[model samples]
Target chain A: MSPFILICVFVVAFLLGYRIISNVPSLLHTPLMSGMNALSGVIVLGALTATTLAGSPLSVLLGAVGVALAITNVFGGFDVTHKMLRMIEGKNRQKRARPELLDA
Target chain B: MDATAYNSIAGILTLAVLYGLHLMSSVKTAVRGNLVCALAMSAGIMMTMYKDHAFASPVLCTAIAVGMVFGLFLSNTVKMIQMPQLVAFLHGLGGGTAAFVGLVILLDIGVANAFERVSACLALAAGMITIAGSFVAAGKLHQLLPQKPLILPGHGILANAILAVMGAAFVMHAFALDTLALFAVFLLFTAGLAFGIVFTMRVGGADMPITISLLNSLGGTSSAIAGFAVGDPLLIAIGGIIGSSGFMLTRIMCRAMNRKLVSILLGESSVALGAQDPAASVSSAPIAPKPADGENKAASWLTCAGKVIIVPGYGMALAQAQHRIKQLADMLKGRGASVSYAIHPVAGRMPGHMNVLLAEASVEYEQLLEMDAANPLFAEADLVLVVGANDVVNPAAMEAKDTPIYGMPILRVDEAKRVIICNYDDKPGYAGVENSLYRRDGVILIQGDAASVLERLIAML
Candidate 1:
């Protein structure tokens, strides 16, 4: 395909993906975010690939910066998600110890 | 194929593989899985640089590795209550990263290309806002900042004036008057950040989850704009998805509270608790607990119990006891008692909070029942196990006019034959008001960690 055609395809695919992913019900969002956040490792790869293929220095720099930022986001998002999950687990444990005290 | 092309393809494939593995792992620990994925992606990026200038790639890769290691260590070390604040910090980091990417693109391309310029500007603004806003949220969650609403005088008018100034600056910047416009942009951005923090601070704890969700959406949108500036399709797609989902979640939360999104944004409806005297005119029918004079002891009670209902809350989320709760539920079922989860819509700190926690524990979705479905069955339940829940089970929402939570729908767990409340203390819920259900004769306040309590309860059974 021509370069123009490839760009069009990229735009179209992104728009379609955005539309489909955007409408996910609130019930499914946290899970999906947890799932997709892990998946964001893809952004790093994309940035690296784009940087490597670039003919110009500006493009290369932009790509490198993008890679760096995307990596941070991936790590940060995962860290936060894990912490949130642990909180949920701790709360559950507290609930189980309720009945024995009444007996005591 | 050219060397560069070959390297690029390899990097992409490696990333895809890592993401797939991360998704497939049922390790149950979200952070551990995410670390593995991030590591793999970083490695792929390093490999691409191996063919040419290898110095920077290795350095970047090593940094990424170090971050992952530190994150993993922190995750294990931090207490559960501190996790949400840490999560908010991470979100701020993500927002900052996206902003950095946008800034880099702008610096590289200059303001020559209108498309890139616009996208970069928006990305920077959104990123800065997200960073500041997340910090504010984290501070509130951690109690570093007060939970009380921070309503500045004339907040609405000030916010509008700041926005208008920002718009004017953008217009001036577009016309090549960069100096004055830059100052205006800086002022506007600062104003916007301050506005977000103050506006959200005024919101009550009951409304925090919605604010967090909205902030998450703002972060996503900023990332998407950054993606556009950098010409990255994946970033745009992922960011847009996150942004839209966050928006929808915020809308749903607002609807649950019988409040409109505009009202929440304007801070008009979230006033201080009214001091109206509670109406005491309801039928004075005392719904007393069944006489505990029967011969069955606590041990025999479980064995003979035909049905059990578990009510979960924010405390359960804080303790991360969903899996243990499910385990106890399973144990109860094995002993011939049917077990089901009673999910209150506004249980915990957010809407659907209990459901989210339970799902994380790998509990069967079918076993969870909504308030409407579970209420009628409570009367028939031999044991009503409340796991770290309070406000949702408080009878005052329906009966007390003076209560802040009046008119809010709650689970009718008080109607159950035996109601066991699992919590740390008799402290009032997020609303700071006492739960009248604590005084109910049928209600039993079981004080301990939810998981340990359930474990002990199961052992006794």
Candidate 2:
């Protein structure tokens, strides 16, 4: 994709995210924050590709580390977000949800 | 797969991820929805790799396997109470990855175009900022770093100067005027990293929530810029999502706290944390702890009270007293005493800090009350339990017009018929001003670890 198109994509996504995030209740901030962190962990994709394209051992090592951290960020971030969202309730609501980690 | 096909597939998955995430906000289906969202994200990632035919790389496989293993272990090992800190740790890792990725591209691919070079430079600078800032935030939330603002004279001017140098270096690289662009980038990286640390340091506990949110966004923005540097469309999309989400959260947090984003970035949080460090706020102040004054008396008030409200703070979380407080609340409920939690928006060290702790401890959802809801209850309540909290409950916000937190809304703890304060010390809270509520007549003080105090109170009840 061209740089201009990519920038436009980012701008559109950002405004959309602002709307979605703004609509959320105050209490859900923490869980939602963690969830977004999980999304950002998608950078792991680049690291995975970089590892294959790396010509030197040092670059490979860097790429490997990047992949590990990015995956860790994604998996860890989402896992905690799941746990956190389960804990939230507004003025009135509560239900015992099954822990999803078992399913994952 | 063709590039077009790959893009289409990734786009569909991203939408699914967004939809899943949107649904995940609902309390009832959150667990299930989050799982689906996570799975979709994972699928998107895997498909992207497969699109490049890079899944067969042994190194990639090994790295991913190890990351999955460690991530799983971390998820299991880390207690829910440490969620904020864990988020910070992940944010730091994200920044570090961006920096490393930018480094690789700079050392290997060099500059592709003005856009690419600018994005790469931005990624590097942002990575340095987040890596340093988030790590410090984690340390502060974990109490490894002091909660107070660490500032020196002329900090703002120096930080701006460093940024100016970085901008000049980036321009030099873009115009092809400098052969040592790598060195310039490194110079900017070092200075920017230092600025991140000092910048976050100048922010106090009162603004921790904003700081954390801000750092989380920086991590996302850096990754998005890194995506541009690496030419990864999927990374760009997801990173933008995270970035915008975080920024919006930060904006909300600032509004909640009645603070501006510019002041936070300018490292002017000492004032934001609240005014001058009056000597009276210190534990050694003349008001005195009156250790013997209340002497094992906290239990009696709870047993007799018809309504009890608990206001928890960062100290409570630091003391790991949420579980015991939950037990106490249960005991109170068993005794036919009404109980509800009063959560201040800026309570504890971060945004939603007390909420997270209370949730982790299984405090009934309805029982946890926001400031708006809980304030009126204080007047009707027979007893108020201020658990390891200071500033949020401080009467200073209302009665004292000269104090920094004067206009800031505070829980009306003084309105309750009887207020019992359970804390390790008589020290002032994050506002750095003494709570006048302590001076009021008939207030009870229960000094010790909150968990043990609550435990003893529960036993007595």
Candidate 3:
């Protein structure tokens, strides 16, 4: 990709993300942050590329570490975010199911 | 796959990720949104493996499996109160990956041009700083390190000196001084690490939300720059999105605290008041001890209250009293008193932290109100129950000038007809400003462990 195209892609993506994330209420900010953190771990793509294309064994070893770290970040972030959302959602579901109980 | 085909696939996956994020704006669809993003990530990984033929590498596969197990372990074990620490730790890992990628590219693949070199250098610097800074923040949150701000002599000057050295190294590498490239990388990495540690060490507990947000942004930006170096379109796109989200959250946190990002970054603690009367300090302020009949009076007030608002803060999380708080709310509701929770924007260690804790305790989302919405209802509230909270409800944020929390927004708990406080002590909050509400005649201060206090209150009622 050309530098100009890369800049355009970055700028457009950033603006779109800014606009969309603004709609997320502060009630979910923690989850939103962790979710975004997971997305940032897309650097695993770069890590994979580096590992495959490495000319030296040391480079490949370092690349493998990067891949592992990025993977942990991606999965850990998404997992925790999922757990939190479920916690909140499960409560809402229970309340919805037992409206009369709350009213009493 | 050819470049055009791969780019097209990347574009589609990027859109899929964005759509998933869009689904995250509401509570109802958020879980599905997370799943969508996860699936999209999986697809992206498969595509990369296919394009790069990385499946042939057994070492890489084993590493990935190990990482997945570790990730699941952390997610399964972390308590809600430890969420901030866990998030910070993950941010560090993400940053570490970007830094390693940058180092590998610089040392092995080699930069093709000044732009690529600059991007790689930037990635390394940003990633290093993020990894170091985030670990410091995590340490503080986890109580592994002291929460007090540690200011070194001439801290600002030392930080600047490190920056100057790193800048020189960056220029040297950008200019194709190939012989000194390794030296430049070393200098930049060490300088970045030093700056990160020095910058974060001076930030006290109250300013952690901003620090965490800022480090989160840096982590994402580092990955985005690393993408630029590797010419990965999908990495660039999603990394940009993550960077923007972190930046937006950082701004929200700063705005909520009515603080400038620069001041917080400079490690200015809560002690720097513009001008203040010593008598207004918590120590100097006269305390009206609770009467012998305080518990009876509190129970009577709770029973008679037609409208009640409860305010919670980090102290509540410390005391692990959210369950008891939920019970208190339920008990009040059972008595036919309408109870609502008032949440300040900066109430907890991180943005929306209290909401998560309350949700864990099964507090209905509808019953929790934001500061703006809750402030107006305080006037009509017959009683306000404060549970392990102080700074967010401190009237000094509004009434007292030149204090650390002055001009910052608060819950206006003092607006209610009567207030009952269950706190660990009568001390000022993280911002170190005396709570003027404690001095009010209508306020009934009950200082003890919040869980025990709420348990007693429940028993009395």
Winner on TM-score between 1 and 2 is: 2
Top candidate when judged by TM-score against the true structure? 3
> What lDDT score is found at residue B459 in candidate 2?
69
TM-scores of chain A across the candidates, in order, are: 0.57, 0.81, 0.90
Report per-candidate DockQ.
Answer: 0.16, 0.47, 0.80
lDDT of 1: 0.59
Candidates ranked by TM-score, best first?
3, 2, 1
Candidate 3's displacement at residue B48, Å, is: 1.0
Residue pairs in steric clash, candidate 2?
A: none
lDDT against true structure, model 3: 0.85
Residues B1-461 of candidate 2: C-alpha lDDT, one tens digit per residue: 77788778767776776676677556666667677779888897778678756678787888888888888788778876677878888888898888878766666656678788888788878888888988888887666876556777788998888788878777766665456776777776887698788777777666788888898888988888888887777678778878887887788677656667897787665252445552223323234445543645767777888898989987688679999998988888898988889988878655677877888777766677878888888889999998888877888877777766676778899898999988777766666667888878768877667787777777676
Candidate that would win on lDDT: 3
What candidate 2 gets wrong by more than 4 Å, as runs, is A85-104, B143-147, B271-297
**TM-scores, all models, native as reference:** 0.68, 0.90, 0.95
Candidate 1 residue B1 Cα shift, in angstroms, is 11
- Quote model 2's TM-score for chain B: 0.91
Ranking 1 against 3 by lDDT, winner: 3
Judged by DockQ cut-offs, the docking class of candidate 3 is: high
TM-score of chain B of each: 0.71, 0.91, 0.95
